[model samples]
Target: MSNKCKTAISVIGIVLSIALLAISAVLAEEAIIRPALAVTFTVISAILVFVAIFYAAKIDYETGVYECRKCGHTFKPTFKAYTLGAHTLSTRHLKCSGCGEKSWCKRKNRRV
Candidate 1:
């Protein structure tokens, strides 16, 4: 999925979680004893949040590859390449192991 889709889902999950909590509060204010419904919503919201997190951390460890533009070398990136580089998707600041210089890198689709 695209970054925009991931962002949208994340926002929706957060909004749904907030709305469910607010509804629970309203039910409590009215002295309603529907514990089951409140718990159900809470659980669903938690699952949604997990899904959003999964989408946000979109690293494919199996077949993910990055190619260095400077040395024409292809290699699998380390987790730090995604976590500590310029950004999760862009690895321009990462040093090429073969070239020993910082260069732009392109992410390749995960091979099946």
Candidate 2:
């Protein structure tokens, strides 16, 4: 899939999750819905958030490469490392395959 499409899907998923949570909160606050139903909606929204995160992570791993600061090498990390390592919006703490040093590596999306 294209990067833009992937990004759009991820954003939509997160937005939908947030909207559901807000709806649940409003329903519970106004007593418009049963408390049990509101609780169910909250749980579903939480699950959706998790699912969206997982999908985004998987896409990142598959469609992007991380550039190591130490050796300037670009490589894909193992899924385990990708998940376990600390990260920011644009970088991840990872061990460079070229230099065997850990650093915050910049993520670059690979051109399709």
Candidate 3:
């Protein structure tokens, strides 16, 4: 599948998981669902959210390379670094492999 398609699916999964969790919370607060069942639903929804987020992170790491602003170098970060690094929607704080400068690097969909 295309990267865009994978990304979209992952995003949708996360959204659905959160929505399920919210619904469960509302049901429990309103006394519409049994407390035990609501707890079960909440746990299941939280697991789903974690799985979805992990999948999304995997897709992001696999599909794109980060470009260092300092040296105009493009590289793929280690999964640990990718996960731990601070980021905005399209940029991540990373140390450039070539220039050895730490900065917010832009994400590029193009292959490394």
Top candidate on lDDT is 3
The segments of candidate 2 whose C-alpha lies over 4 angstroms from its true place after superposition are: none
lDDT digits (tens) for residues 8-108 of candidate 2? 89888888888888988999999999999989989999898889878877877888899999889998899999999999989999999889899999999
Cα displacement (Å) at residue 75, model 1: 1.0
The per-model lDDT (C-alpha) reads 0.63, 0.90, 0.95
TM-score of every model?
A: 0.48, 0.92, 0.92
| Candidate 1, 1-112: lDDT as tens digits | 5545545666676677667667776775676857787677667767766665554454343335677888888776666665467745545456777777776777675554
What TM value does model 3 have? 0.92
RMSD of each: 5.7, 1.2, 1.5
Report residue 40 deviation for candidate 2 (angstroms): 1.2
After superposition, candidate 1 runs with Cα above 4 Å error: 1-51, 54-58, 61-63, 88-92
Number of backbone collisions per candidate, in order? 0, 0, 0
- Candidate 2 accuracy as lDDT: 0.90
